[model samples]
Target: MNAGIPAAARELTDRLGPDAVATSGPLYDRTRRVWNGAVTNRPALVVHARGTADVQAAVRAARDHGLPLSVRGGGHDWLGRGVRDGALVIDLAGMRRVEVDAQAAVATVDGGATAADLIGAASPHGLSAVTGTVGAVGVAGLTLGGGYGLLNGRFGLALDNLLAADVVLADGRAVTADADHEAELFWAIRGGGGNFGVVTSMRHRLHRADPILAGTIFYPLPQAAAVLDRLNEVLSAAPDELTVAIAMLTGPGGAPGLGLLPAWSGDPAPGEAHIDRLRRLGSPAFAKVGPTTYSDLLHANDEQGETIGHHVACRTRSVPHLTPDTVSALVKAAATFTSPLSRVLCGQFHGAAARVPVESTAFGLRRNHIMATIISWWPPGDAEPHQTWADAVSEALARDALPGGYPNGLSPDDTTQIADAYGPNATRLRAAKTRYDPSNTFTATPLP
Candidate 1:
C-alpha cells in the first residue's frame, strides 16, 4: 500500500473498495483525464464515487484531511475545474444513471451522465433533454453553469428545465434542492458554479422534441454580411421552434467561408417554410438543411474532428445585436485568423430563454441576444498562437456585447467576472454560498 495515499482515504478503503480508490498507475491516469487535453492535473487521489454515500465519504475525507477538493463529472469544462493539480477529485463518472419518467416528462440523471447518455435515454420515449452542443459535456457542470443547446430557443436552457437536484455539500450533508426545498441553494446552483456543493443527481424537465429539420449551410466570405443581416431579421421575428447557429471558418482549399445550422423543433410544415427562407438568405457554396434528430445536431458541432484531446481555448460573449460593425469585425477576424482548426460561432438566444424573468432564477442574462463563441485549437506545444488569436477575435466581437460571458466559457483566469456571470442574482449566490459552504471547501472557482 502506498503511504502517499491520504490516511483519510484509507479510512473508507473497505467501504468504497480498492477499485474505487486510485492513487497510481493506469487507473489513476484515467481518472485524471478530462475533455480538454490542455488541463494537466495530478491530484493526490481520485475517488471513483459510485453513489451519494461514496460522494459523502469523499467529501468528509477531504474535509477531515484539510485537503482542497474538486469534483469531476464529465470533465469537459474549459476551466477544467473538475480535477485540479493537487486537490482530491470526487470522480462521479461511475455514478452515471439516467431514469426517465415518461408520464411526468422528467429525467432524473446522475451527475456523471454525459449529455449523450441523457439524450439517448430520453429519445426512445420521444422526449428530449435540452443539452449543450457537445454530447460529452457533463450534465451537472453544464446545468450548474446554465446549459445552452439546440433546443434552448424552443424549450429553454438546461438550467431552465432543471426541476430539482440532489446535492452533497462540504459538511457531508446531502439534500434535495428545488423550488420548495433548499430553495436558496437551488437558485445558486442554477447559474452559480459548483461553489456550494457537489450535485449527485439532477431532475430536468424534458420536452417532446425529437427528430426535426436541422443541418448546415455554407457560403463564401463576401456574402456573410448580408446573410448575417438576414439572419438577424429572421431570428428577431421567428418563433421559438426555430433556432439558428452560425459558424465562420476557413473552408475547403483555405478560403474564408461561413456555415449555418438552422434547427427547427416543430412540425415540418411551418419549419420547412422557415428553413427555405434561411437557405435563400445567402448564395451558398453548399446547403444541407434537412430533417434529423437533436442528438445528431449535438454531434454535428464536433464534425470537424475538433474536440477535447486537442489544445484549445474558447472565449464567448452575448451580443444584443449583430450590428454592422459587429458583423464586419467577425468577418475580418475570420479572414485574418490562420488556424483551420479554429472556429467562430454565433447562436441565437430567444423564445423561452428570453421570456424567463431575469430575477426568477439564477441565470441572470434573460435578454434576447446572440451568444458568440471564438474557438481556437492547436497542437500541444503551440498553444500561444491559438489562444492569442482567439482572444483577439473575441476582443473584436465583444464591443457591443454584454459585460459577462457564459460561466461555462470563462477560463480559469476569469474569476473576477463571477458577478457578471450571475448578474442580478450575484448577492443571493454569495449568501447561499455562506449558508451552504461557509468554509468555502469547494475552491475550484471564485466564491459567489
Candidate 2:
C-alpha cells in the first residue's frame, strides 16, 4: 500500500463527505473491478458522485491535488478507460436517471444511464433512442463516440440525435452546452468523446421505432461468399429504413456459418417485403424473422454470456464496398476465431447516418461504407493467440479497406493511428482542447 493513501483518502472524505467517498478497502477494489474484470489498475480513491454537486466537488479536489481524474460513466467501454493507477475516479453509476418528454419527442438521460435504461424509459412513450447492439452499454460513451445501431439507418448515429448536455469542466464549473450555448464544446462532444469535460446529463431526440421487423438468417459455410454478394447488393439498394449486421462465426454446433441480422424501421408491410428479398439470397440452414420491438433488437447482442474475466479486444476497418475479395478475406479471418464467443461482425454506415456531413460533428468518417470488425475474446490467461489473430485480420483488411477506422471498434494498436479516427476534425478538436482543456486533463483515451 502507498504510504500516503490514508491521508489522501481522509482528506477526500473530509472535503466531499464520507457517503460519497471510497478509500483503500474491499469496497474500493470491488468498485474498481466491477466494470472490466480485465482492468487491474487501482485508483487511490473513488468518488461516488450522487449528483452534479458531487461531480463538481470531485473535479475541484482533482484540480487542487493535481491528481489525474477518470470519469467512470457506465464503465462499459471495451478499452477499460474507467480506472487508472494513482488517479481519482468520479463514479457516476449512482446517477442513473432517464426522463421522456413525449410531446417534444425528446429524452433526457443522466450521465450514468445505460442504453437499456434509456430504452426502457422511452419505449413506454412509443418512442426510441438510436442505441447500439448492446442495451447495457453506457449511453454517454456510445453516443459521444458515434453510436452505430439498428435505428442508425432511420435516424442517424446516437450523437446526431443529441440536443444538449450538462457538463463540468476541468475548472469545476457546471454548464450547459448545446447548439445555442458553448457551441464549440457541443460540436466537440458529439464525437470527440470525454475530452472536454465530465458530462452530467444529456438530452437526445427520439423517434418512432416500434413494430420493427428484426431477426437473424443463418446460412451454411459454403454459401458465405454468395450470401455476402447478395447482402452487398440488397443493402446498397434498400431503403433508408433497413440496416443489417452480418456476422460470421462458429455456431453453437461448432461449424462455420453466416448470420444476417436485419432490422427494418419502416412500415411492417414494406419491411417484410425487404426481409423476404434477403431471405431468398442463399439457401439457409436456419432462420428466425418476425415482428419485434426495437428495444428487444437493441438487447439481442448484449454480451452477458461472455464472462467479464476474459480478455476482450477488437479491430475494425471500413471499406467502400463488400467486394468479393473483401468478403473472402473476412470469411478467411473468421476461421481463426479462438473462442466460441469470438467472431467477425460487419455493418454499414449509410442512409441517414451517411447523409450527415463530416464537419457537422467530430466523427471522422461520414460516407456510405461497409465496416468489418474482428472481435477477439479469450479466457483470463490466453490473450496472445486471440490478439494475434485479430491483428492479422486487421492487417489483411487494411489492404483493401479504406484509410479511416471506427473509434468504438478500434483496438489499442489501431487507435494510435489517430488521423484515421478523427479525419478532418482533428485540427478543430485539438484547438477546442487547447481552449477548454489545455493541460490534457482527460487522458484516458485517444484525443485529438
Candidate 3:
C-alpha cells in the first residue's frame, strides 16, 4: 500500500471511525471509477457515508484538507464526475433509505436511492414518480438534471414532484432547500445539478395511479422515420396521460430495430386508444404492452439484471417541429446503426416535462416533444468507435435544437457546452452560482 494512503486512512479512520471510511485495497478504487471510462478519475479517499451526519463529516473533511469534493450517489454518472484525482469522494451509495407516505402520496428518498428503489417503495402505495429509464441511475442527479421518464408527460418531471431537499452545503452546515426555505436554492435544485450543495435526502410528490399500462414496442429499423412521423402527429393531440419515448437501435442479437418505451398514467381503456397509434405503425419485430405496477415498470426491461458495463452517451435537442428534412436526418443517422455494437435513439420529451414554465426552475427547453438522444454501448475496448458514431449523429441533430442540456446525460467534454442547453436561463444560473457556490468548490459532473 502507498504510504500516503495509509496516512490518509488513519486520519479519516480517527475522525470518522472505522465503519464510516475505507481506504484499504479495492474499496477506494471501486468507488473512484464511474460508468464512463473516457472521463475516469482517481480519488485520494472515499468516505462511505452511512447517513446525513457522515455526509457532513466528509464535506467538512474535504474543506479542511482543501480537497476537491465529488458527491457520488448511484455512481452511474456517464461523465465520470463521481470521482476525481486527489479529491475526497463522498460516496452516498450506503445511505439508501426510502420512506413512503401513502396518505400524503409522497416518497422521501435518501440521496443514494436509485430510480428502481423509489419505484419499489411507491409500488405498495399504488403510486409512482417520474424516474430515469435505467433502474440504477440515482434519483438525486436525475431529478437535479430535470429527470425525463415514461411518466414525465403525465406527472411532470422528477423535480416537478420534488417538494423539498435536505442538503449539506459546501461549508459543512446542514440545511433544507425547498419552496418556503432557501427559495432560490430550491429553484436551483429543481433542475440544477449538485452545484450548490450535497443533497442528503429528497421528498417527492407521487402520482395516485396503480398498475400502469407500460412496456416497449419494437419495430424493424425500416419503420424508424415513418413511426416518428406518426408519433409527432399523434402525440400533438394525445392527452398528457400518455407518455412515450422512441429509440432507434440494434437490439440484443445485432439486429437493427426501432423501439418505443410507452407508459400510460390514465385509465387502461383510454390507454388502449392511445396505444393503438403505435400498434398500427407497422408490423413490429416484437410487441409487449400491459398493465404493470411502477416497480414492475422500473424493473421491466431487466428486473433480474446486475450492474454491468452499461455505458451510454446522449445528445438532446428541443425541436420546433419534426420537419421532413429533420426526419430524413434522423433516418440517415438510424441507417448508420448497421453495427450491432452501437445505435441511435429518438425519445419523445414533452407534455408535463414542458407543461412547467421555463422560468419555473433552472432547467430550460421544457416545451419540445422529440428529445433525440443518440446512444451507443459496447464493451471497454470498443468504446472509441461507439462514442464516435454517437457523437457524429448528435452533431447532425444539433442543427434543429432549441438549446438547453439535460444535466444527467452530459458528457465530460460537454462541460462548456451546457450554456447552449440553458439558452436564456444561463445568465440566471451563473448569477445564482455566484451567490451560492462562489468559489465553485462543488463543481462536479456536467460542470456548470
Per-model TM values vs. the true structure: 0.95, 0.95, 0.93
TM-score of 1: 0.95
lDDT of 3 by residue, 205-228 (tens): 988877788877888778877877
Off by over 4 Å in 3: 1-9, 37-40, 303-307, 310-312, 338-341
Residue 261 miss distance in model 1 (angstroms): 1.2
Model 2 has an lDDT value of 0.82
Encode model 2's per-residue lDDT on 1-448: one tens digit a residue. 5555566567768877887788667667766874345677888789998889988888877777777889887667666677767888888889889999999999989999999899989999999889888777889988888888778888989999999999999998999999999999999989888888888999999998897899889887888888888788898886889998888887657887888889998989888889988889989888898998877776666643335666777788888888877888777876667777678888767899989999999988888887787787776776788888888888777777887687766645555456668889989988988988888887545763
Error of 1 at 211 (Å): 1.9
> Model 2 RMSD to the real structure?
1.9
Which residue segments of model 1 deviate by more than 4 Å? 1-5, 252-254, 302-306, 444-448
Model 2 per-residue lDDT at 441: 82
lDDT (tens digit, per residue) of candidate 1 on 1-448: 2343468668768778988887778988987877678888898888999999999999998888877889988877666778877777899989889999999999999989989899888988988888887787888888887787778888888899999999999999999999999998888888786888989999999888778898878889999888987788888897999988878887776887888878889999999999989889978888888888877766765565435577778888888888887888788877877577778877788998899998877777899888888877666777877888887887787678786778777775665555587788888877888899999888544544
- lDDT of predicted model 3: 0.75
- At residue 131, candidate 1 shows an lDDT of 87
- Number of backbone collisions per candidate, in order? 0, 0, 3
lDDT against the true structure, per candidate, is 0.82, 0.82, 0.75
lDDT of 3 at 396: 72
